[model samples]
Target chain A: MAEIHLDGVAHSYLPNPTDERDWALKPMDHVWRDGDAYALLGPSGCGKTTLLNVISGLISPSHGRVRFNGHDVTTTRTEHRNIAQVFQFPVIYDTMTVYDNLAFPLRNRGIDEATVKVRVHEVAEMLDLVVHLGKRAIGLPADAKQKISLGRGLVRSDVAAILFDEPLTVIDPHLKWQLRRKLKEIHERYRLTLIYVTHDQNEALTFADRVVVMYEGAVLQVGTPQELFETPSHRFVGYFIGSPGMNFLPCRLTASGAEVAGQAIPLGGTVLAQAAGASVLEIGVRPESIRLADGGAGLTVQVRDVEDLGARKIVTCRLGDHELKVKVSAGQAVPAERATIQFNPHLTWLYADGRLVR
Target chain B: MDKWQNNRAWFMVLPVFVVVAISAIIPLMTVVNYSVQDIFGPGQSVFVGTEWFKEVLTDRRLHEALWRQFLFSGLVLLIEIPLGVMIGLAMPKKGWTASLTLVLLALPLLIPWNVIGTIWIIFTRPDIGLFGATINTLGIRFDHTASPLDAWVTVMLMEVWHWTPLVALLAYAGLRAIPEAYFQAARIDGASAWAVFRYIQLPKMRGVLTIAVLLRFMDSFLIYAEPFVLTGGGPGNSTTFLSIHLVKIAVGQFDLGPAAAFSIIYFLIVLLFSWLFYQALLRVGTGEKR
Candidate 1:
């Protein structure tokens, strides 16, 4: 297996991109370590698919180079790059049997029939498709067809990496978890470098050891699930990661402390120094990090709506003109009209502009 | 819970039935009537049971015409299908070139059959026409009116020229209907150019190819106008196809009984071949095991 690296890569469908909006992928450098599971997480039109295509050699980057194991392969064709990609929709050869579908790549490489048969069976077993080996691929259900598509990539052991572009989008909901777990098992067993692209946070967080969060056409953060949930590097990451997302309140950094809505709040010296740049300032805290407190203490909030979510409740409150959400456990009492809430000092973060302050 | 049986639905379909009867059934019945009768005049006719059918089937001229019809249609299909698919594949996929190509290809199909015949008649004249004069100027004795081989070749060329575009246009439409993802998948699978065509494009174009085959078969089998105008069944009846022979018997000799019998047999042959072609193509296209 080889580590895939994008060195200052950018792409534009237009011949001459004059503005930032014209570029599909802004210039960025990324390295996917060998044999590690990584997920490129972004919403639609954020260039995640563009980045995947560049890595797979399906499309060449307009600006920079793609290197595999330190060798530039930006202009190499997809087949020569030794990469396997599973598309968003299941793509199976309709005229072939399930066995033949899995054997196609190996046969195209002129692999011997004996070895192809062995590998095909092995992959079919791994994908739980042994029962369908003799069945026509066209007649199979969507999930089974997707399994055959995945098996095609997995059947070849010589591939550098197997990339999945939202492969489970067409699968039934109940089967998604099973298929995902199967993929994880296969990745661990084979030690194959797997890069999955998806917009669903749950899928990205659970599937990848490190999730690369992207916004617009740029990478915002590359961190583990815990790190992304606890310490988001950019405002978008913080807002996009959690269920209720992190709340931001307008604030000003002073020589002595930080002030929010004319009330002085405690701030660490490192955070205060990091926020020293003269620009927009805000304090970000997760909904779960804020606790309801007694009245006339800390920051007072007017309770707007409370949604009971079994074990915990999401308390949406108004502090001045800013809206904040506080997550309280079932044991905590919520006031009808107003409630005082205090942010956990260690969990709270400061932002100068949109980037997180150390 | 009894359902209402609407007897009025039969009345709703009566108009269509009447139109079909007036346009198709009445003419067909008249042919059948003539096939079984010997008409002396407007009111004097003899009931001849299967006599004209036996006579028409035994006619040596009918045998020659039938064989020629099959050979012509077979030649047309063999030459046109592959040539048309190649042209379709060579056409541009997008932009101005695609539009221009489509417009040019559709020009021949829009011309009337007799007009195509008339056009070829002038174009293939050995004395003055461009094609015939050029071949003769090159020192080759090419006269479609005098030589049987030249007559056959000219008729085949004219037929191919007039009808290959229909196949090309159909094949082009089939080629365009395939999704881009299939090509991408084939590339990732490391398929060669031939493999892509064999496994992907050919199978995808099966539906349109069936249409092209059936249409070319039926149209070529019944071809009359172009060959009739170009050679006029000259060179001693070398190009007297089934339809041309039928017209000659019906109109030229006024042998209505035998001509009507020949018409029924011709219709049956086309119907049988079309059904067989449809079944064979459907089986191949779907790759059905049974």
Candidate 2:
């Protein structure tokens, strides 16, 4: 419903932040477009929640200007900003009935009772809470309480966006997807601008149109899930986004290509051209990119272990003190001990000082 | 999962049973023994067969004292609960200032009850006391010794001053237990200050508030030392509550038969009221229409 622009935003809880470690959220700029779903993805203590709070106007950033639709709103309070945030722990008015709980936001904003009733029913219906509309909010299951928290945000018509700070943390595993799908459905029906902050990669990839991966209080990369997989902008993103994350092997540059364990691994001219001046260089490749080459056309490595994961087998090998994993279909031919493996040139990337070379 | 069916766990509870029998049951049984008999001497006594209970129950002065006790407790609760909650809400949430203020608030509650009364006795003297002299200086008639109204006011003031801090401390603990997210959520909902207090704060404080109410009621209902030391049950029995009246029969008159019966009845009355109060509070909490 509204566009949010963060210009040079930085925050530190300390009175004087003299270094990077002192800052809870380091400097950054972003424009969150209107009516788009976005996810802030990071592990705990990575400042994703702090970033969400800054956007919601819960905390005044130490340095920056926040704009809403090109108008300054840096000092606006949360109530005035028209932001609705669902916290990790569900906060419900336990003494009130579910109807009253959902009606609270509208009533607080002085919306008439007639409109409040209609909107409350609409939200309850969308949330599968129609049967519990008349019951008290207390003594319900945690998942139900979480739904009530979400419903509280949905009942307000003037809300510009709904911010979720890991709202599904308390939900049951089976109900997590159901709630996520309900959120997607709500976003589709209303086109509400939503920013969901979660440490879970699966949740972030499943829920958002764009995922912003954060590490150590800084945004590493902002891209779709596919982009994060195929071409991660940062090595941290490469490591964080995938299951059994990307493998890195320290490589030294040569006239032709990079040499890994004294073996020449070919690269595109642009990649080697960019890596020519880097002091620190490494090659990162995913397990799926490594294949068992036929007739010993590649490096012969000692196979250490094979992990069977249903349809595929991951062959972990050691090539001159560097460990590598080659993912293969269960039906593929694999040597019992020594196997020849080759990296897919299109999928493998070169990193200089933990950043992509090209 | 394996369920342990051992009966040896019962022996682990024997120490608690012994401690309860020695500390509570023995003394209570002695009171019950005295309540049913008329003692002529240390070893010679006769079974009174509930005569003393009837006398103690029917005494007009005792009836007045019971009514006075009820009135005092009712007024104390009506004043202390809200005032304590207000103080709790007004206190700083954190930092060194909050710790300092908590220490200052607890100073009144740490004084011994008899010492509180002794301090007030001098502090409320018509001529020598600062409080009483200040009131007289303001052109007000002041004397806790001569007028029943003055004595009642002085005792009520002392009681409130000494016990209100306990309630405030409990309420403060309750308020502090609420998570910060609730306040953030309330702010985002555009809730007014009063609405936040009504819907979020008050509901969260209900459990501690119930404990505060029960403690204040029982403590005020059985109050004795402060009023006795400050007013000496004086000004024609204006502040002589049930405890003071019972003490007067037991110690001042040494009428053991009726005093023992009075003590038993007083205990039962408190137990009954506390049970009734707890039930009412719990009902008010859980009687939601669902």
Candidate 3:
């Protein structure tokens, strides 16, 4: 296993990328520590897969160096890079048995027959594919085929990293959890550096030790799941990580405090100072951090709609032209028309130009 | 379920039945009638009750012709399939070169059968043709009209030249239909070039290869215009195939009864071989399940 580092890496599919729109991945520097499980999460076409391909050595970056354990490998081909990648679609050798499919990478490297057999059987057992060892891979269902693909990646012992590009996309919903748990177990047992690329937030939050959020071909924030949820460095991360996302309201920063729609909202002195000189000012708060105030002492909101979600209900309200969502527990009474909502002092965050202010 | 149903559906199928009867069944019945009868004239014929079939089956010339036909078709399939697949694999995958190569390979397939035979005949003439003259100048006395070996080689060459492109085009289409992910996965698996072709390319090409085999088999088995025009069953019947011999009997010598009997046997042989080929092709896929 090796730590992978991208130094000022950028990629573009175009022969000549003169404009920002031509680049598939913008210039960025990131490092994946050895034996770490990291998820590169983003929406579609956000360069998550492009970053994965660059890491796998499938595509060389147009403008930077890729180093593995401090060794420059930017020009290295995929085969010599000793990395295993599982694609979105299940790719299996149709003519081979499941056993042979798992044994292929090892056999390709001239591993001895006995060792190849042992490794294949070991990986097959780990992937719960022991019963299917003798069956042709083409006859299996999508999930089983995907398991075989994963087993192929795990069969090789000398791989530097195992990269997954949406490997669980074709799996059934119930089976996805089981497969994800199995992946975690394998990661712990093998201690292999794993980088999973996906557009799913839950998969990233649950599977990764650190999640890298990307937007519009650029890295937005890289942090642990709890850290990203609690204090997102960028507004996109705040909006993307949580259900119903974080709400942003236009505001102005004054010497006293931050004011939204001419109503003063409580903020720390330092946060207000950080936002003082910003051309764009806004306040972000998660829906769960906002509660209906019992007394009329907070910002007044006109309740537009309420969606009951069993344990908690989402209250969508309007304060002038700005829309806000507040999460209220099932036991709380929701006002029919108007209510005053208060933001938790510690949970509320201030943003100046979409960047978190302190 | 109701005991009685509308009979109007039968009318919907009448047109298809009429088309089939006129196109296939009627012609087949005529062949059967001719096979069982001793026809002296169009209207004056006597029922011979398998006499002609027994005579045709026992004929030594028919046996020789059948053997020659099998040898020619076997050689054609053996040479064409691998050669076609290799050419397809070597072809460029994209851009202007790929289109140019495809157009060039498809040229032979567009030529008419009789025209291909005529072109090869002039192109292989010993005195004037480039190929025959070149070989002759290289100290090889090549004369397809006189030497049986030369005639066989010429016919095989002509067959390969005219039809190998068809198999190549089909194989190319199959190769193109395979997704890019398979190749990427193979590369990541560290598979060698030969291993990639053996495990991925060949298995994926099975469907189109089956079609190529069946088409080449049927077309080569029924080959008439090309060889007939080039050789005319020449060199003392050394290159006479089944269809050529059958034609000589039915039309050249006007022995309609024996020729008709032989035609049925020929048809049955082709049908049996084609069925066997199809079964073998299908088994390659599903047999591993057991």
Candidate 4:
């Protein structure tokens, strides 16, 4: 029910952080809108967990303030913040039955037993845990225990948000998609502000409406999955999001065209003008955006290998010292030894010092 | 390699068998042998069918001692377990202070058993001891040697002071093994400190607490040196626990046959209680109706 704001929030575990390297989370401002399914996506050591803890009020940020609906709550305790968090592993009360575990948060708030019973049963039914309501939680299989951890949060009607810290890491591989779809259904039904943290790109792309990509303790971009795929605002985002990722080549911008790794590629005048004066320039094209030409229609290249992946194929080509990949459709006939790669002009982009140029 | 497959591996185990027999089995069998016989001298004994067991089972003195033994062990467990867990909870989680506190707690447990008794005698003697002098200075006539209640109190104090550290050490280890995520989840669930202890910390600690309970129970049940040296079963046999009474029978009266019978009964009683305690502790929250 709350829209959270992180205003210049940063954290460092050291009491005396003399340099930027000591900061676990660099300062940034963000707003997680109410009722949105957001994913904080990054690899390990990217400070996503630190940021999640800040929003949950587990750790007070060393810098800047946190606000809910524009009210500063930087000093609030976790329980008082009206938030719930599920850890990476299941955290169940070993002595309590599943029903009691689900009822814990509501009972702690002094809810009446009748209401607690209703909410616990409803959540158990939603989680497909009704059959286990009478069983002790500790000895249950990991997936069921994890459901209890999440159920405790769902039972609290007044919680502002429920955060998940890689809650599906321990689930069986086949069960992961089922549980993920269940979470999406729950989000749609209740419209809770759900912020999930994960390092897997597929999970982040599917579960969240907005994927906040981070790297090296810094958030690189925040966008929808389509926007991230079509227009990556940072080079790292372009490299990290796709299956084969984006291919980059050192290039020189000119008045009429660009020279890419000792080969000339013609560009529109306006496109060349925008990247006219960059000290460091590179052309980025997605594997899906590049086409293979057998008669050398575009930039000439040496074919390295072609790997078929069911419906489509990935063509690995070499341009001077640079290796480039092109995703060809099922109908395209590629040469065995040599093929020219022509980047689709609209999908190609210019990057200066790892940042996307418009 | 297949020149001959001899049974030399069996010979390797013979040495261990001999060691085990000499250390444990032989002495145990000797006690069992004496429990059912009337020994007059070396190689001159008569088989006495279940005579000594029947006599020892009905002895009034032994009955009183058995009751006292149960009371002592019950009080020991009732006092030490919670006290030790609290101490474990209060201990620092990390850094130099945690190690320092651990070393301080272990200091009492490291003292020799008889030395602990001698130390308590010096500590509780009515005239020259600081504790006794403090009571006398307060206008109270208190002497452990003369009063049965005072002797029991002093003996209980010495036992608790000496062995509570073992329980605390085990509890501390259990607490440390719990992952930090459980505490975080508890806080997020709005659980109070007491609820966290009841639901999370206590449940997580049951494994170690079971061991602690059994160890303290059996040790306190078989207690001999500390109370024996401090009170000498004194003040009209008020502090005569099972072991002290058994010693009085076997050594004081030199009635080894009945003493051996009494020892076997004592051993069985301890084993039964320990087994029952373990089963009850482990079954706290197991299954529910389908």
Tell me, by TM-score, which candidate is best.
2
| Superposed Cα RMSD, model 4 | 2.9
Point out the worst 10-residue segment of candidate 4 chain A by lDDT: A269-278
> In model 1, how large is the Cα lDDT of residue B113?
85
State the lDDT at B34 in candidate 4.
Answer: 96
TM-score for each model: 0.92, 0.97, 0.96, 0.94
DockQ of candidates 1 onward, in order?
A: 0.52, 0.75, 0.71, 0.74
Give the better candidate number (1 or 3) by DockQ: 3
Query: Residue by residue across A1-358, what tens digits does model 3's lDDT show?
Result: 9999999999999999999999999999999999999998999999999899998888999999999999999999998888989999999999899888999999998999999999998888898899999998998999899988888888988889999999999999999999999999999998999999999999999999999999988999988999999898888999998988999998987677788887888787888777777888888999989978645878888999989999989999998899999988988989889899888888888989999998
- DockQ comparison, 1 vs 2, better candidate: 2
RMSD of each: 2.6, 2.0, 2.0, 2.9
Candidate 2 lDDT over A1-358, as tens digits, reads: 6899999999999999998899999999998989999999998999998898898899999999999888788999988998889999999997888999999989988889999999999999999999998888897889889999999988887678899999999899999999999999999999999999999999999999999999999999998889888888788998898777888899988877889998998777887887777788889998888887544688778888988888988888898889988888988867778878888888889999889987
Q: Cα deviation in Å at residue B164, candidate 2?
A: 1.4
Interface RMSD for each predicted structure: 1.4, 1.2, 1.3, 1.0
Q: What is the lDDT of residue A330 in candidate 4?
A: 75
- Candidate 3 lDDT over B146-231, as tens digits, reads 99999999999999999999999999999999998899899899999999999999999999999999999999999999988898
| Model 2 misplaced regions, further than 4 Å | A293-295, B1-7
Model 1 regions more than 4 Å off: A255-259, A262-265, A276-279, A293-296, A308-312, A328-334, B5-30, B39-49
lDDT (tens digit, per residue) of candidate 1 on A89-118: 888887788998899989989999999999
lDDT of 4: 0.90
**CAPRI quality level assigned to candidate 1 from its DockQ score:** medium
In angstroms, how far off is A80's CA in candidate 4? 1.4
